[model samples]
Target: MRQHLWMICASLALVTASSAMADNFGMAGCGLGSMVLQSNGKEQIFVGTTNGTSASQTFGITSGTSNCKDDAATVAAMYISVNQEALKRDIARGNGESISGLASILNCSDSDALGTSLQRNFGGIFQNTISDSKEVAVQIRQSVYSDTTLASSCKAI
Candidate 1:
């Protein structure tokens, strides 16, 4: 009886481990990171980090509308653009602003802001950092409560 019990526990452990591994593999195939965003009972965003020494960031947002996918794409693009701008400013000023400061300037308050600031101010935000090669990725999982996700990307210059 004890042997049977031990076998069952081991089997359960193996199953759990395999399930977790499968999930990770599935995410990798999608070219996305481990973070997934879901809101309004819908999946809305996915983010992935790139491997490199340069500070990089990427994110996607979906709103369940005709422009949902496009809006998400735009957000990702703007994130990169804003990050580059912030990096230039930090380099010129020689100051390291908190992630919050950078986010405030971008009018964002969340992990997305962190990713945006890192991209905009790579030089200062990730200077001499071992993780510079890894991109801080963000993804919009859902946008039901707020259309700001779409507006932010659309208004980005």
Candidate 2:
């Protein structure tokens, strides 16, 4: 159908744009939805719904495909980069879904503690005009390592 083709083309265009700028994935995480919907903002809700409905996110995570397979650092960085807007809001508040998700990925035992730590060092982790996810990830890791309790608590960071 023409509508389907247009949607696919639009999705690809979004993916290309986001990938070129930040090498970021969709808010749906890793899955078919992520592949088809790479833009941020409200479109993320659609992406998440698609992934959830299709169960591709589970498959991708289990099978290590669709951007699910990567080193801890790389995955963490990609997550941080893709969820910058959420992270920005949550980090300012010192607790939210983004922080919780990051804690899970980084294998931290205490999501609240991690969120607090990130909130405490918000300025440093989110420094001026950081376009690179890897850079932001490194800063986050460094922030975690700087805190003695958090360093010991987060096994993957």
Worst 10 residues of 1 by lDDT: 51-60
Best model number under TM-score: 2
> Model 1, range 1-157, lDDT digits (tens) per residue?
9999998678656644544333232222222222221121222222223201111212222222211233333444455355644544553453445333434443453535344433444444344434221232121212211344433642321
Off by over 4 Å in 2: 1-62, 65-69, 129-131
Model 2 per-residue lDDT at 7: 88
lDDT of 1 at 132: 28
- lDDT (10s digit) by residue, model 2, range 5-121: 998888678775555433356556767666666667788887788789989889988997765667778789889989988988898899999999999999999999999999999
Error of 2 at 95 (Å): 0.3
The lDDT, on a scale of 0 to 1, for candidate 2 is 0.82
